[model samples]
Target: MKSAKSETLKGWALALPLLVVLLGFLLLPIVMITIVSFWQATEFSIIPAFSLENYEFLFGSSVTYKVFWATFRYALITWALTLLIGFTVAYYLAFHIRSSNVQTILFLVCTIPFLTSNIIRMISWIPFLGRNGIANQTLIGMGVINEPLEWLLYSDFSVILAFVHLYTLFMIVPIFNTMMRIDRSLIEAARDNGASGRQILTNVILPLSKPGIMIGTIFVLTLVMGDFITVRVMSGSQAANVGRLISNDISLLQYPSASATSVVLLVTVLLIIGTLMRFVNIRKEL
Candidate 1:
């Protein structure tokens, strides 16, 4: 009994720090948000009173639904593009490359974009994608079009383009890590059994890479869904999303409204992550 009690105490001691951090940071903030979400807010003052007005407003507004649809649309499109590009890159790195040194170097190359701040990298695209910018000038020089494409920047295309550029690394790294852990003998055996390259990839590699793909999907979806800056900057405020909605509410001194919107967004993101985790053993795969 004494030994077991001592071990239990030690375990608790180890876990205490994490428990403290989670309670102080994550749980406390959520509790505050939930509380504030029920409180009343005015233009000049936040009143300490309980009300469901914020939620009623949020749910009743057609604008809210449209913004959420835009959020989901961004998540889906970004997820698809990242998966396709990330999978291709990971496969080439894991299977095609013979030398581990070369693979490391190439992987490092992929991370070079990450060395700069995200804002700077995103802003850099403006010059490249703008009218009379590199892309437009190059296309014009090649006689692809007579005039500069206005939709190249400050549009949905730019938003998605920036998303793919920024988050592709997130998708690539996880998939590559998972792919690296796959057994070489399985691939060799599949080859020896007269399995085609596609057969080997589909049967052997893809099934094993699910954890990574799911993880990457989670990362990209969360980032894109919670992002207001990207949409605002890239779309020139023409596009609306849940994040921007919350931000607008906050800017207008509507604390209750922002909190309510934030709570809804939190629930939505949690549901998505929960659903994905239900099918995959992310901890085991990692």
Candidate 2:
């Protein structure tokens, strides 16, 4: 009984720092934002008046609806592309790369982009896609096109490509970790039992790796949904996303409306992640 009590105390002591941080940063900010969302802008200061007008405006506006749908559509596409590309890379690394040292080097290379500022990385694309860029010069030199393609620099395609480039590694890491845990003997046994590589992968490997795939998908979806920088930098004026819309509201000093929009976005993302978490052991991956 004494030992149990001591262990419980130790656990609580260890958790106290995390608990304090959560309350200070996340919980307090959320509480404040919730309160602020109810405030109304009077002649001078925002008055504390509880109303659903902000949300009503957000939902009622056709512009917000379009932006929300755009955000959702981008997230869906990003998640799909991340899964496909990440799975191939992770599968090859886990199964084909026999040398652990080489695998480690490859993984480090994959993470090098993350070491740099994300904004810098996004900006780098402009040089490659600009009017006097390599893409244009090469195209014109090779006679593929007589002129530079303006569409390449600022379009939905560029935005999606940037998203896939940035977040694919997030998906890859989780999938790779899961793939590495798969037993080598399982594959050998399947092979010895007259199963081909494709059959073994389809029947055995895929089912076992569902947790990783699910986790990667969720991560990509949530991150893409929340991302503003890539959309703004890559899409230019051709596209509008929810993050951009929220930024516009904040810039215009529509604090209550922005808060309401943020609250809705946070709730929607949480609900989606929560639903996915029910079917996955996300804790194990972490």
Candidate 3:
């Protein structure tokens, strides 16, 4: 009993730094924001008083619902595309690639874009997808269409494309990590039993990769939900999202309202992450 108690104390000592950081940076801010969310906002400044006026205004506005809906739409689309592409890429790297060196090289290549600024990478797509950009010009030169595609840029398509480009790596890394840990003997045994590729994948690999999928889902969903810069730049400020709403509020010095909106977004994201946690204990998998 004494040894176990000592070990527990050691574990707590080891975790002390992380606990302090989390409490100082994360939990404190969250608590402050939650408190501010209920405060009253005046024309000139925020008043420190308890009230649901901010939330009342939020629920009363149709624009709030529209912004949230648009945010969810973008998140769902981006998550689906990233999951599909990431899974395919991870599967190839884990199973098809024989050499560890080559796999590492390829994985590093995949991460090369991340070394630069996300803003720069997002803006780079503008010239390629613009009205007279390379994409439209190529199509026109090939007689594919007489006019440039108006929907190619400054639309939902461009926003989703930018998201997929930026966030696919998040999905790939986790899924690949999970795949690498899977036992090769299980796969060989399944094959020896005359199980087809589809059967083996469905019955074995998919089940084992759930933790990675859940992690990836949580990452992509939270990212897309909270992102406004990509949507702002890619959509030419034409699109609306919850993040944009909060940003605009902050810009106008509506701290209380912005805090309320942020609180709502945080709660929504937490609910989603909690649901995902029910399916996979990420700690155990890791």
Off by over 4 Å in 3: 1-5
Query: Compared with the true structure, what per-residue lDDT tens digits does model 1 show for residues 199-221?
Result: 99899999999999998999999
Question: Candidate 2's C-alpha lDDT?
Answer: 0.87
After superposing candidate 2 on the true structure, give the runs of residues whose Cα lies further than 4 Å from its correct spot: 42-44, 284-286
Candidate 3 lDDT tens digits, 56-108:
99999999999999999999999999999999999999999999999999999
Q: What global local distance difference test value does model 1 have?
A: 0.95
All candidates' TM-scores? Answer: 0.97, 0.93, 0.97
Report every candidate's CA lDDT.
0.95, 0.87, 0.95
lDDT of 2 by residue, 1-286 (tens): 9999999999999999999999999999998988888777643456679988888888898988888899999999989899999999999999999999999999888999999988888889888988899999999999999978987888888898889988999899989988888888998999999999899989988877878888888889888998887899897866888787778777777778778888888898989889888887767744
lDDT of 2 at 137: 95
Tell me the number of clashing residue pairs for each predicted model.
Answer: 0, 0, 0
Cα RMSD for candidates in order? 1.0, 1.9, 1.2
- Looking at model 1, report the run of 10 residues with the lowest lDDT sum: 41-50
